[model samples]
Target: MQPLSHLESFVRSAESGSFSAAARQLGLTPAAVSKNVARLEAGLGLRLFQRSTRKLVLTEGGERLLQQISGALGTLSDAVAGAAEAGRQPAGTLKVSMGQAFGREYMVPLLSDFLARYPAILPDWHFDNRQVDLIGEGFDAAIGGGIQLTPGLVARELGRVHVVAVAAPGYFGGRAAPTHPSALAGFDSIVRRSSPTGRLRTWTLRGPAGEEAAVEGRPRMILSDPEAMCRAAAMGLGIALVPMPFALPALQAGALARVLPGWYADAGPLSLYYPSKKLLPAKTRVFVDFVVDQFHARGFAERMSGAGEPVA
Candidate 1:
């Protein structure tokens, strides 16, 4: 019997008219989707999609196969979805991905609560800085900022991520804290290198009253990890722009202090991304709702977005 995954890929590609579109819906890469379709065609000894740079057109055999299997595929999907919804327990291995620092700070603590709430759901969470392919790598969901939306995927805004300037308490022992973004020029700055691009990131600060300024300073150190940037700042190496989540604990412990109060760089919304909205498994559905609820309940959205009274 032909593999069901290939059939699903074939039908989705035919309907969507491109592998990229099918990839978005199925959570696989275009290459992977094409490979699946090609494999299906090889097994059946037929050219399914007319290879082209512009658009994928189905062959006569492909059309016949699609017409014959489309109904069966729908029936299979509905049956599986019905079974998932009717299951008494949301018992399954829930694979998830998130940023290492963000996960450590926010998601790790919440796992206990989530597991407690859904005893049958097993959590397999991977923490990394790189963007993950949710469908290709088989992740049920991902939580982070700036996730690229592909076909069939949905994003829920958890909160805004803000970057703030931080320095060690000792670094400012005799010097006054920077009152404005321009004053940061006097300090030695530890900047982050973009992991994917290998380029240094610049810090642009937005004031409470809607003022904007980009910090220009002597680069004392360059690091790639946000946690390390915060640590370097705490150790008096240099003032660093860091995500608030990575700096929160040290700030609370007096290891690091905010340099410019009420000024932060908005890094856009932190989102929880997952696959298509149709007939989602109970485990994934509950987890998405639970995480969003936690963010709202704890005021993380306000704190992270630099909107609340203050972080004192």
Candidate 2:
């Protein structure tokens, strides 16, 4: 690697247009600045500057060298500054991946406050259902359910992802709600088809007392997306098995009602996944902490775990 001192002196002299001015900037003697530039030129086998009695002017090669090296020097300086700042504060782009429905419903709403708290950190979020290769895709973090933990990746559980059956209030206007998981078999249901396997899914539900039942429904409509299934149920199509996050809003709005209340399918933990780097970026650290804090504060953990009692 070329000496940073040599490159510094060369760039400083080029920008200042004289050895003496560059010396003032570097806190070095004019002679030392001139020596460093001369050494740099000799090392590169080029005459970088044409010296007159009045001022030093760039030769054609000098102009090209300046154009090339100036940007590199700036980049190097920025890298050094960023490294130093990493110890001091969270700053820079915070790239996070999340499911579209979850991010929109949960995270995007909190961004205003997060940004206000950390003005230096810019949020770059990708909303998609596909499991991203966090390191390979250059993502700082991800939040979702059922993300397989790969080597060098660590996960912090935000909560459990439990699936529950729900339907529009109008759908159950006259019909009685299912009192148990087995009763769900009698209802017309909107169900998910596994996107990867292309097979219809059965809802395997666990009651509050730890009873498990797999209910196969007469599929009124088969869909893969959870949001779509919830919407279908909201339109009074049929009961839908959906993640609690997707169902909660409609449930709260009274657009939908929970069916077989205590029974839910345990999909697994919802987690925030990030690289297990020894020195995590401050941006990633703060973001992870912030979101986790919000989840706990909102009782999202409990709600996601199917603790929120269904409305009668």
Candidate 3:
């Protein structure tokens, strides 16, 4: 029988279409992953992949074997990991993916404490602007908003993300601040272009009276990132609608002022996502618990919800 490691190497390489990608996910050298796959092939007396300089093409036999073993291998691996480390300190590289701005501003602050508690765990975090495939990419966890919940995954809601209109104090140049969402159209606006769909994003603001108003700016500037929009607004460019998390710092620093303080757009929930397994990994479990605790203790949920803002 081939070792589980050999099978894992083969499966991961096939799934990723490259030995180097598999190696990165597995935390192994490319040479080692290739050697393991070679060993598995030799033992079975069959070629699993037709390798080229660019990518690995799975052979017919490889496809059949993968279909037969993928689920079983995952089950076995989860069980083995749980049973083997039931009482042991979780010590391994913990891979996670998160949005760059949110991860840097919020999640990164927790690193020091996380490391202090689990000194043996090494953090390997990837900061990205887009959603990532958690299980397919072999990430231990991810954090963001608006991620579609796929099979074999679960989410823990962190907070309601709210979008508020803001601008530099001097942006309006003595023009009266907008009293309603509809008034925003008369002003120059810094807006966001949706990354996944190449369309301009629109905002609908909800008022205290349960009334809603759809609004769009004059498109003085367009950016793909919320953080950048916040910065552009702070630089006296134009009014911008940005998520509370991206605007909080500037708002706190008095660099930006709310445009329509009584209204805000309901974006979505920020969440921590991970694979749903019968026996979750110790590192992931601890990290999840710690984050939930921190968020509650810090009142981040309320702050991000626009509930903490004083109504004008």
Candidate 4:
């Protein structure tokens, strides 16, 4: 098959009726344009032009070829230009995956302002507890912690994932508040079961002085979702180890009290995950930047670290 340049040269030369005019349009020398046309004719095994010193005339085959490819070339050029324009302008359906509780609590609130700013961008969000295959599942972005950094994916750290023990203030009425991680084992605990592994999740808390202690929560209620654990704790079901992002509102509202203020388990970094930065779509790029900026502006990283002032 002839290269696109060859087809372009032939088409332009035919349209202009002169090699020099085609060369001027293509930003090439007349000789180069003639050579490209000749190469195209040779590849096609059909003479496409009857050349003259004064003007170039299209042969029967050239006329047929021109008729076949001219409109197609225009359409291809339009498609390319449209794609480039779409890249420059942030306007598309942005599909994002995030945790159910975290998305509702944090990201969903940002939608009003985000849509107001980029009115052309339509947000399609999926809320779930498990990690999603960003590229495979055709997701624009995902927000969560502990997601494996698979090949072809990039993560921007929004904050640290810290799990703090929390429970209703009344649940601690008769029993003494646990000062150490080991003491958590004696209380009625609401623990999460790993979604993938189906095994009980354990907590290893790190103190301010770098002391580590394993928490063996005696599970009165075994749940799969962190938000459910927080709700259970709020209902005075048991002491629950919940991620700060899921537990923050309850703590601030006095619905739940921090069990051990000085200790928290560093699960991993909460991140915005997307495909590689190369030729990243405008919608995804803006959304990533917006979320990161918002997280920084709101001090979400520090507040979710469990090292902030007690919220109970």
Q: Name the candidate that leads on TM-score.
A: 3
Q: Tens-digit lDDT track for model 1 on 32-64?
A: 999999899999999988979988999999899
List runs of model 3 lying over 4 Å from the truth.
38-64, 133-138, 148-152, 169-175, 195-198, 307-312
Off by over 4 Å in 1: 1-6, 9-46, 49-79, 307-312
Model 4, residue 282: C-alpha shift (Å): 1.2
Error of 3 at 230 (Å): 2.2
Query: For residues 167-268, what per-residue lDDT tens digits would candidate 3 score against the true structure?
Result: 998887777777888888898999899999989999889987879999966889889998899888989999999899998888888888888876898899
On lDDT, the stronger of 1 and 3 is: 3
**lDDT of each candidate versus the true structure:** 0.84, 0.83, 0.87, 0.84
Selected candidate, larger TM-score, 3 vs 4: 3
Q: Candidate 1, residue 76: CA error in Å? A: 6.1
| Residue-by-residue lDDT tens digits, candidate 4, 1-312 | 678899888877877678877776566998999899889888889999887888888899989999999778756654664578673558888989998888899999999999998999999999988877675465879998878887558999998878888989899887678889989888889989998899999989987788999999787989998888899999999999888988899889999888888799887899999976455667888899999999898888888887655433
TM-score of 4: 0.72
Instruction: Locate the minimum summed-lDDT window of 10 residues in model 2.
Output: 303-312
Each prediction's TM-score against the native? 0.81, 0.72, 0.82, 0.72
Error of 4 at 69 (Å): 26
- Residue pairs whose backbone atoms clash in candidate 3: none
